[model samples]
Target: MKKLRKMFVLMGTVTLMVNFCSFNILAEDGIKQVSEVQTINPRSGNVYYKYKIINGKKYKRLWSADKNAWVDPYWTLA
Candidate 1:
């Protein structure tokens, strides 16, 4: 049972890493369609634009046109 759990954990981690890498690549290649959309701060619930995903393991990525800056939504909330 313990070995099974360990195997599952390892598999899950590998799967996540692969998915993240693929997403990061697509984001860089601009293959994902990015458009202007109204988004709300998960914490503040404030609306914002220039939304985008930045590739990082520990940080969030967002581009705000109003502020003309990049922000990490995760850090903003948590």
Candidate 2:
């Protein structure tokens, strides 16, 4: 009766909160930013810069450089 109804409401609230938290975590895990220099080789060129991986897709992080840094162009894709 009243006690059973209260328990069900509490359970529903807990479930909703858990779902919201999990969704937020999943979103956060998909993409992230890095500050340190890492070797990157894309079809465009090779250079060292911070990079990020989002949803398993890689993207380059830009940095200023005067000289071209040598890197194996194949290491990134192959």
Candidate 3:
């Protein structure tokens, strides 16, 4: 009985570690997208835009070289 209980505990620990690692991997993808969006910059006379979706809504913002910031207050709906 003691051996059986130890086996179950080991299995549970392995399952939890696998789940935690997968969640971290998924979160890293989101962080990568945000970092990519932040790197966009307007060139010459053209305006550069980036979009992100959140909560089933699409939002967009443009880089402004004149003001050195994003044009929208909190990302307007695209």
TM-score of each prediction: 0.38, 0.40, 0.39
Residue pair clashes in candidate 1: none
What local lDDT score does residue 55 receive in model 3, on the 0 to 100 scale?
100
* CA RMSD of each candidate after superposition: 25.7, 19.8, 19.5
Clashing pairs in 2: none
Quote the lDDT for 50 in model 2.
52
Q: Residue by residue across 1-78, what tens digits does model 3's lDDT show?
A: 999999999999999999999999998877643334466665655457878999999989997766677866678899
Clashes of each: 0, 0, 0
The window of 10 residues in a row where model 3 has the poorest summed lDDT is 31-40
lDDT of 2: 0.67
Candidate 1 lDDT over 54-77, as tens digits, reads 463343346665556655545432
* lDDT digits (tens) for residues 1-78 of candidate 2: 999999999999999999999999999888878699889766554445656676787756444343454343332411
lDDT of candidates 1 onward, in order = 0.65, 0.67, 0.82
Off by over 4 Å in 3: 32-78
Estimate the TM-score for candidate 1. 0.38
